[model samples]
Target: MKRTTLSIALLSTVMLLTGCGEESNQTSNTATTQSVEKEPAQKACYDVGETTSFERKDVTGPRCQWRSEHNFIVYSEDLSKPEYPGTLPVKPGYAVRRAKEWPREDLSDASSYDKPRIQFWWNNVSSRDPLVNDYENGYKIWSVKIDGTDLRLVTDDMPSTASPQTFMMSRSPNNRYVAYAYSYGEPLIKAIFDLKTQQTIQLGSARTKPYLVWADDSSYIYFSDGFKRYKYTLATGIKEEVDVPLSENTVIVDGKLINAAGLGVGVYDAKTLKRLYTILPEKEFEDSVDIEKRIYRQIAISPNGKYVWGINSYRKVLINVEDKTWLAFSKEGDEKKVYDKVVNISNNGRETQVGAAIITIKHYGSDYRYELTGKGRQSWKVIQSGQNTITPVLYNADANDGRFLEIENDE
Candidate 1:
């Protein structure tokens, strides 16, 4: 059955390929005339330069060269951290607690691994935008070891052209390949850099702005070209358009594509191109308040893909995919029903706790500060709070089961 399915897919791909050239140029010229103009084949990767060696002292910033033998995890410290210049640090098991200072200059980008030592990328300077000037004076790639030793630069030579705007880079799941996008105004180009061979291949001109999400190590790469979701096979060089149109943020789970698009979230089958299920947004909550006046933003997805975590109307919510149930944490009501800004649920969904920050409200020319009652043996506590941002980092199984851990302020 798998072989038969494969045969049908191949046949369908051939038909699509026959019309791609005409389809790509439909706006520029008529289909008949455009048929003669062929679209270039996708290259396997993109090349910037050869890998060379450089010491940390040679770069402008303090300790500018770094590389990691293991896959490294990249995260941003500030939520408002700009699109670039955010440092990707190797998640060391032991925490390095020090006075707040600039991140290492040499390690700019990094990948995540499960165990042992992970790898990270560094910039020569502490600027938020590292690659903005890489093409001007040339940029270097460095490798850092797990123990924070053997930091060295490795890149052949820099490109002649200025670094393209919106240069985004991500390592493949297997850590064998690094993919990046070179934004050229309207049309964006994607390229994959082979870490083992030190070579690059351009994926060809993207139809729309391309954002990449990898499926796995071997078969296919999932990338969205604005409106449509496509899977480009590295082995066959074939691109297949899926039925589902993906949003900017997409999550791959159990070989499925899950994304929030238009009224609900969709679970799509990557192989067969079918939507298995859709979880519509809860209208009850939206109708309770004027949704038009609120701003909704998605933050993170759980590793298991069972919950969708997001902030709506400055309040955090956890939406369960299985039941389509909405759990909200807010600071506006009674103890039994109302909550502040922080809420946590156990993995089994059995235990839950809600935390909130105390806020002062001025009404009728009077300043009123609301606080939680039933402090000793009952529910909820003010874990963390401030004027700007309130973050409840941890919650216990019961009201008094565990104390609110900490509240982080984002000012």
Candidate 2:
């Protein structure tokens, strides 16, 4: 459905109603109760039929890493590979327009950000990109609210002709700037899209693989071309070199420099560049299996700073820093099934910053939800049953209706 695209000023400005006189405290309370009762509930996600609901493994308590059929799916996207070759929309520019109340429109290939409040993905059959296999011609970045409202184009035509590839794409923590890398020439073209200004600018080019990180302030960004680290300010258009020996895969999550490697996950203080946390591999598991042989991938920290997950091909470990507990399933060690998985932690609302971590795992054409018990234990339960259903708030923004990017090949 189409969004009521109000300007930033209009949306940000709070409307204050004036009256002849103020109401009494009791009357105000009554009015407030009525307003609260009458307000509409937050939108919920419904099945697009393309996705399904699967099983959830209840492997929680003392042990760690569910090394058997208890493994759940983990949904994640690689920023390095932004555009994947896929089928275009049949109608191309035809977007379904709807009011605030919506029907289950086909959100086939839609992909959502970690936040899930908004979704952004490239549209191949868009009116902007009318050519076939002419991916380089131009494409549009379509965005919509989680409730399927406020559907609008976030970026103008991103021409592949100018940028042979638009890789390493990410939205800023503030959601103020959207950055990506493209091939302009010998140097890699790195561009930023200002959501407020609705303008896209080529900050400059890099010689490296083009890994970018936005500062918490959103005023500056740090990126690595290869081994060289540089910072660019959005307001001043100034780029400065930082003498930090960082690599291309370095990412800034919640303002921390996250380095996920063979050593496990390392969370660093982005400003002082000090190591804040060095999450090592579980020693018990390390002793049982070969470090080089066992796979440890998709290392992510909960946004609430409560849990850290080391999603392995065979085993998965959940860590709570306060208690120093490495929790997982009941079983351990062995060749599990072909695990196509990506686990995400979210809140009740798509845009809420603080709340219980709604731990979701997608595997085998279905989804399962688990909760962290009050004692910091994992409480596994089937939140939804049936086909591939999403967390009602996520509007699929990709071409392949709700298809996730996960490969079980642990190498």
Best by lDDT: 2
Per-residue alpha-carbon lDDT of model 1 for 202-256, expressed as tens digits? 6655556666666644356666655666677777878887655554345565777
Residue 276, model 1: lDDT of: 86
Q: What is candidate 2's lDDT per residue for 138-233, written digit by digit as tens?
A: 443444432222334456446644443433555565556767666645777778888667678776665667666666556788776655777888
| Clash count for each candidate, listed in order shown | 31, 25
> What global local distance difference test value does model 1 have?
0.40
Global lDDT of each candidate: 0.40, 0.42
Task: In angstroms, give how far residue 164 of model 1 lies from its true place.
Answer: 6.7
- Give the TM-score of each candidate: 0.45, 0.49
- Kindly report the root-mean-square deviation of model 1 from the true structure over all alpha carbons: 30.5
Q: Score candidate 2 by lDDT.
A: 0.42
